[model samples]
Target chain A: MESKPISLMILDIVSILLLAVSTYLALVFAPLEAAMGAVQRVFYFHVATAWVGMLGFIAAGITGIVYLATKDLKWDIIEVAAVEISLVFFLITIVLGSIWARPVWNTWWTWDPRLTTAAIIELYYLAYFMLRQGIEEPGRRANFGAVYALLGAPTIPLTFMAIRLFRTIHPVVVGSESAEAQGGFNMTADMRTAFFFALFAFTVIFIDLLWNRIRLGNLQQKLEQLKLNILE
Target chain B: MSAQREKDQKPSAGFLNSVLAVARKDLAAELRSPELLLAMLVFALLAIFIFNFALDLEPALRSRVTSGVLWTTFAFSGTLGLNRSMAVEKENGCLDGLLLAPVDRAAIYFGKAISNLLFLLLLEVVVIPVYSLLYGINLFNPGLLLVVLLGSVGYIAVGTLLSGMAVQARTRDVLLPILQFPIILPMLIASIKASDGFLTGVGLEDAVPWIILLIIYDVIFLAIALMVFDYVVEE
Candidate 1:
């Protein structure tokens, strides 16, 4: 692995600081959502992490395209990094959403399009890793991984659209006389500020994590090559 | 001279012949042993039984559960046939032989996909009769059968491609289903909705959109898998 540049190291620290400030802003500066109490506080981190999760998925897809075109191992490494970070962030988002949902909706899970799509996307990448782990040849692994990643990308959006279309056509009548009742909430200006800033903060955090993860990937590859050379 | 000729003109029936030969070979092999088709059939029946016992509802209540049960059976048993079909080819070293043939990779993909779809459809055809008998619900709706065909086509399209890649991995046996189920969710959902609509006496107007979505998904992924198969099989 290459030596850590001073700028990346500084960026790492800045991300941590920003995350802390963002949490504080979410916890303190932002007012609690009136209808939902303390649980609403989880929304800031939830959306932030989900934002990064999405960013990671899109990044991995783009890197998959680039890797296929260039036939480069470096892009494969970047793809893995983006996928791993996104997987963890999406897990956090799901958990936080579940926790928040418990109090608000009285259910741990819902068939909402985005949540279901997130779960499916998470599974898609899990399959991605499993696919990578099975191949013994590095070149074949890189090629197969790139191909699978590219193939999996289209299904994610289609899955999202299918669910949305299904829901829209058949509205769920959940104990409501008024038609305006199925899980829709209006956001105040203050809530919007906190929400958007959390997204911004998480974007920074995602870049930092992606950088570290890619560096770790590089280190692992170098060590493997070194081991091969020493054996020879 | 051969390289120049090859570049200038396609390989006529040689390529298509190899593809058809491979497909015919697989079909004949399965016909003799019948292990792949039988296993998928038994698995689909077992799944329907499990769903029946698991739900433990009256016959009157079974209509609502029929679509879900039918699709689940198809999905699970389809995965079985897919994994076994590819695993057999890999174990016998035939996959490598197929790759060595003078055929376009897309031809191999289509050939495998068609055979896999055949296996799935065979199982589904039998499962419907067994399910209707067991649950005492009618399963002969034309629209429902249409959904079955379209859904299985989409499922097998992606499944055959992924199973090809999965069979090459170290975790070959267990990896196919893990890789397939998540990616196939859209097809599953669309199929279920369309099938449910038909089974419950809903209009074709209600089901056309989901069918359109299925057609779009099948076309897009078929193109993607076709394009990517070369990469997957490349040395």
Candidate 2:
């Protein structure tokens, strides 16, 4: 395998540094939420991770469409990288949301639409991997993966809307105070700064990880092709 | 120009005929064997029985739980029917023969989907009465029946498309539900809600949105499956 590029090395360093800064901003710079106390602090990272997850999901969907149109294996690699990153980020978002919900909602979990949709989206991602694993031929595997990703992509928005329409106790912090009854709070300037910065930091980390993953996928493909050639 | 127009019109007409031809093939084959419907009905009965024992299904509880229990039975057995429907095509090499026929691929999709819908409806026809007889809840209401039909259309639309893809994979049987369940969650939610409304005699205004959502899901997925069926079945 080729060594990591110098630019990626720089990005790796920058991502770690920004993560540290964002953690400090979240942990110290933001005021302790009056209503929920320390547990509320998890919201910064929670929303940030969810933001990255959404970004990765959209990327996967677009790449899936492009792969279908162009029939290129490269787009498939990028789609998988995007999905893998989103899967990890969404996991963090769900766990953090659950932790923050415990003290505030007086329950470990709520059937809030957002949480439920997140859980469902996680299942879609898992099923994506399982579908890919079951296909032995690389080209067919990529084709099936892209098609499945495309079909599965719309569920995220529809799920969000369905849950929103059904009934939602999840806090809609960024918008109007609709969820005030459900422990939604207004963000002060400091909290906003931390919140937005966490979003920025996570976006950077997401790009950094996505680049590394794509490179990894390329390497794996190359290794497979090499093995085939040697056997022939 | 006249000859070209005739050629174009011929294929469009052929598409519908081809779709029906495929559906008829599946229906005739299934009638001869009768195994798919038999399995689905038995499985639906078992699922209802399990729910009966598990939920205690008292008279008061039966009304509230009927929609959920019925939809769950349909969803589980629906997968069985879908997997079997596609697996039969694969096992008998019918898929390759269908593909080699000079028909629009979407015709094959519609054909399989319609046959799958018929099998599921057949299972529901048998299961619903059994459920009612055992629980003593009259489930013959017109509105509830409409809800069941709409819900099954949405389920079979997506289930047919996904099962077409799943049956091509190595882990064919196990992959369908995993690929299907999360995507079909909205349909299940809407179906259960709409069925509950109809069974409880709620106002049409109250149930309209869920019914509308079900219709929208059915249309959207049917369009998507038609457009993408070519990619999935292509060599």
Candidate 3:
């Protein structure tokens, strides 16, 4: 069996330390918002997590194209890792957005374009997984998955546009302030520090998680190959 | 109409003939059986009843949400038709036969999509009248009809490709909606909102944006289906 790579080990340690520092910066170092109170702190993590979700989104698109062009299974494994990670991060982004919205928007949910698109994106990820799972052959599975990923890539923008149009055409029923997302404040220096640090920290964490996931996928593929050999 | 004339066409003309031939094959098959259309109609009519009772759609609420109720029926029954349409081809070994033909795979896609669209439109032609009669809501507006045409086009475009892929999977019957609903939500949203605008006499200006959205969605997905159908149906 191959040992874990030293570079990955270093990344894992760095991610943990960065996360600890990031959380401290967000929770304590950042001054409280004058408007929405303490719940505003969730924005730091919320945006960061959303950023990671976008990474997954972009990764899924590139891997899909790369797989289709190259017809390689390796890209499919990487696609799955990117999707799984994006799925979890998107869920976190939604929950955190909801938490912030509860106090700020005075409701648990708002059909804001960005958040609604994120929700739809989560559905796309699950559908991708389900589509992959229903097929047994890796080659065909990857083909179908790659096709869906490519077809779905443009829909993120389309969904946002459609939903935003809907909001404009029909009144939100939830009054103007919440409806228009007019409830945010300009960040001071302290908040800016926390914000940038959170983004920086989460990027490292996302990279570390993606690397580990790709390693596991490769290992799983190897195991499947070994089982086939043993049976033969 | 003869084989000689069809063979005498240009490349693009041959492509059209191939598309029409495949479409004609499907239409002829459906005409012979008629079960797919009948089932979709019955399912859609039943959905109207369910939505009516479920919403207790009073005159006031009826006018407001009739577009939603109508599209909801179409969306559900549309999925039914899409699933059955592909599944029938797969089940009868007709899909393999189609693939073996000397034609572009995208022609196959357009052919399937066209037949599917016809069934959906025919279903709507009946259901809308029946629904309006049942609820006393006037639904014969031209704008709404235009919305229906574009909406079903958008639906069938991607739905055909997705169902083509779904029908090959082990859990194909259930896999399609899971795969389809989210992707088509934007299209549905556009369609429903546009229909609502027209139905309520909100004027052309109100519905144009949504109509544009539908057109954009249909064009993009049509192009996508053309590009990706080969992969979905590849052996």
Candidate 4:
């Protein structure tokens, strides 16, 4: 491996330290809900990961657009970096949400709008990778991947709205009619602080990971180009 | 490199005409053979039959589950038809012929999209009546038809574009569905919601938003597909 830059090393260290601090705050500093206890603490990291996931998602779409507009291979690398990190973070977010849901909602899964949207977004990212995997030429792979990424943008919001509307029309029935509001709980000031801090921490982590991934993509591109040059 | 010079020699308008001509040829061929349509229709029917036994849905349960079943069958059959259509083009060198045409790249995209939409709509129309007969459910609601149309349009619009790319891959046969299902999930969900709304006697007001969502999806994706089709088709 090539020697890493000092700034990148520092950013990586800072990311790990912040992630540790965020976990500490979420697990111990935040107050627990009366109904759910310790499991409710999962909400902080869950929301934070989701926040970063959305950031990556939107960034991928924007980079996709840029790639299409300028036909820039660099933007394609950036897009893939954002999407891969988003996929991993979103998976964690979904798992964490499920863990939290087990205690709070008394079920490990809910077809709730936000959760459903996250799941769809996860699938979208998966499809993005699959599209890239199928092509032999790097340029074609980047172009097709960029196209599909842009195509998926509107559908994500529509998916959220569809589930939301479906829920509103046919609320999840569990014995009583009005008891459907139990999933949401009020957050205390300390919980809010932890929650916001987790978001901030995850954002930093997302950026750091994205930059590393982009560098890795560049390295891979360089190796491919070198191999082509040696062959010719 | 020579292809560009050949393209430049022709008037752009003539190039567009040739693209439409290619679309027309596909449509006319499908009209004649009817094999594609017949296959899709029968596959859809088989899917519904399997679902009938699979779910064991009663009259009351069927009302809610019908949307899911219908969309599921449509999705699978849609992918099947998309694969066959694109694979045929690729196999016969029709796609390469189109690529060699002096037309805008988007012309190829639209041509495929139009023909794909035709096959999907044809199957949907046939399947609806069969579904009504099989289940004793009246599916003649105009609102329901509108939702079906919008959903198929959105589904096929993306399906056609993606399948073009998928057909070029090593895993051409299997890759289309794997790529299609996730991207089209929103359309499936939205269509299911709207179709269920119509089936259960829900008014237009209830289904309108889903239909609108489908329209917006179709338009946005169509634009994106047009913009990037050049890249996918580039040599």
Candidate 5:
């Protein structure tokens, strides 16, 4: 595998810098939330991580479809990279959400649809790895992974709808007219800046991590080929 | 021209016949041995018994918990049936034989799915009455039965596809449920909700959305399984 490009090094530095700034903004710049107090501050990182998670989820599905269509191993690697990054980001999202929920909802967990769906999505991706591990042949493994990824793609939206329809106590942060009325507070200007900056920071970090993981996958593939050649 | 006409008609007619043929083959094999059905039935009954002890089902609480218990048992036993059904094909080399046949690959998928669905429904038929006998609650609600049917369709549709892949893996049996459960959760949730509504004598308005969701899950998964089965079964 080639050395890390200069651009990626710059991205890594920028991402780290932005993450520090984003955290500072959330912790210090944003006004303390009236109802939930300091715990509500977790919302900035929570939503930003969830946003990055969603981005990875969509990328995985799209790359999965492309792999299936083109029969390209590169796309398979990209799909795996996307799913891995999404999995990590989503874990953060869920944990942060739970932390926020503890102070606000007076419980560590609630069966809110978003929470339930997020948990299920986490399990779904974990199962993706399990399925891949059980297959020895690379092509077949990639094929099954792509098919499973495609099958799981629809579940994300459907799961959200199912949970939303069932019932939801989780705050709808944006685009709901009754947000403020539903125990959800509107973001102040400073909070909005922190929130959007967090989102931007996480997107940059997700890309940097994904690029690094793809390189790792390429190296792993090369090593496997080398072993096969040596054995022959 | 006559030969071309016959060839054109053959595949279409052959498709349905091939599907039924595969289904019949599995049915006949199961009838001869009865291993798959017997195991699923026994396992399902054991699950219910375990649930009875685990939940400490008092008479008053049984009605409320019955839907959840029944679906859980079905889902667990369904995975067993799915794993075994596909494993049998792999063990006997029947999968390769089926692949070599002059039929659409999707027919094999439909055939396997139908057989798996039949096994689940049969288990439900016996288990429901047994559950009713044990709990003394009437389990013969049509609405609940419809939920069971739709839920099984949705479950088996995806289960068949996943098991087909799972049975090919090194960790064949252990992998199906892990691959299946998360994806099938929505259907399970909807089924349970619909079943509860029916059991509690809730109005149709409350249950209709769940029923609709079940149907949507069934149709969407069945279509996807058919489309993707070719890739799954490709050597």
Candidate 6:
């Protein structure tokens, strides 16, 4: 058995530590929001998770392209890892989003632009995983996955823009829009600290998870090679 | 290596000629059978009827809902045509033959896309008139037709590419829509909005943004599809 690299072990510990600090800051240090009260705390994790999901999504797309260009199984490993991680993080983001929404929007979900786009992307990547599953040949699987991810690059952005062309009610957390009017809240000093900390913590955690997933992918590839060798 | 040598030795065909040749090949084959088109046409008509009844769209509400109904029908029927179109290639060894030819992969993609676009246009031509006659709506507006053209271009651009991938899968039949609908959602939204605008007499100005969106999507996806199509069809 291959040992986990020292850097990865370090990353694992650091990620846990950062996550602990970020949670403390978000749940306790952060001032309670004025309007939405306790429910509003969900925003800190929601945005951070969505950000991590976005990172993994883009990473998968890029690695997909790189896989095609180089025809390297290594890139394929990275691509799948990115995709799997992205899928889980995106699901969390959606659930966290719904938890935040149920109280504020008075419904579990709304068909607003961002909300709609987010949900559609979740489904889209789910299909991506399915597409990869239907093929047994590793090379063909990699090729298709890469192509699909590349396709997502334009499709996802276009989906967002297309929905925006209709209308948007998803609150702009950072912009000048009155948060009270839109059921969003601008951050105070402590909240800002928490928000930024959460973002940093999640970024570290994302990297940790991604590295672990990629290691698993590499091991799976090796196992497949071993099985092939036995068959031969 | 020998194939590359053979490709280089042959007289060069114009890029457009190869693209047209591929599209013509698909057209000729489809015309000979005519079943795919007939099926799409029938399926579209059925969707329109089903929606008309299902939505309980009375005469007063018909105009408002017409564009939605038409696009939904097109989307569903378009799926059928796209699946059949690519699945045929995979079945008859046509895709391999096409790949062996010295044509650029983009030409094949464009050719298939163009033929798919034509099939959709043909379906629209027949469906729109039937829909108009059935509903007593004057559906022959220039703006709406323009939107349809642009929308179909964007849609077929993505569909042909995804369907190419889907047809290779074991679950090819079900995979196309799953892989396609989300990606195609934007084009569908813009097309429906633009069509609705034109049908409602909102003036070209109001529909202009959607039309632009359609064109932009068409251009962007076509470029992306063209670039990645080689990867899709590779051994």
lDDT tens per residue, model 2, B1-235: 2223433645677878888999999899889999999999889999998998899988989999999999999999999999999999999898999887767777889999988998999888898899889999899988888989998998998899899889999999999999999888888888888899888887587789889888888888888887777888888
Q: Candidates' TM-scores? A: 0.92, 0.96, 0.94, 0.91, 0.96, 0.96
**Fnat for every candidate:** 0.96, 0.65, 0.82, 0.78, 0.73, 0.86
Q: For model 6, how does the per-residue alpha-carbon lDDT over B1-235 read when each residue is reduced to its tens digit?
A: 3334544655456567888999999999998999999999999988988998899978999999999999999999999999999989999999999988876677788899989999999999999999999999999999999998998998898999999989888888999999999898999999999999999998888898889989999999989888888778888
| Of candidates 3 and 2, the better by TM-score | 2
TM-score head-to-head 1 vs 3, winner: 3
**Candidate 3 Cα outliers beyond 4 Å, as residue runs:** A168-179, B1-10
Ranking by lDDT: 5, 2, 6, 3, 1, 4
DockQ of each: 0.79, 0.73, 0.76, 0.62, 0.77, 0.86
Q: Give Cα distance to truth, residue A106, candidate 5, Å.
A: 1.2
lDDT of 4 by residue, B141-173 (tens): 988888898988889888888888898887889
Q: Which candidate should be chosen as best, given lDDT against the real structure?
A: 5
Better of 1 and 4 by lDDT: 1
Q: Supply candidate 6's per-residue lDDT for B218.
A: 94
2 against 4, candidate with superior lDDT = 2
Name the top DockQ candidate: 6
> Candidate 4 has which clashing residue pairs, if any?
none
TM-score of chain A of each: 0.91, 0.97, 0.93, 0.92, 0.96, 0.96
Looking at model 3, the pairs that clash are none
Lowest lDDT block of 10, candidate 4 chain B: B1-10
> How well is each residue in A127-163 modelled by candidate 6, as lDDT tens digits?
9988987888888899999989998988888888878
RMSD for each model, in Å, please?
Answer: 3.6, 2.6, 4.1, 3.9, 2.8, 1.9
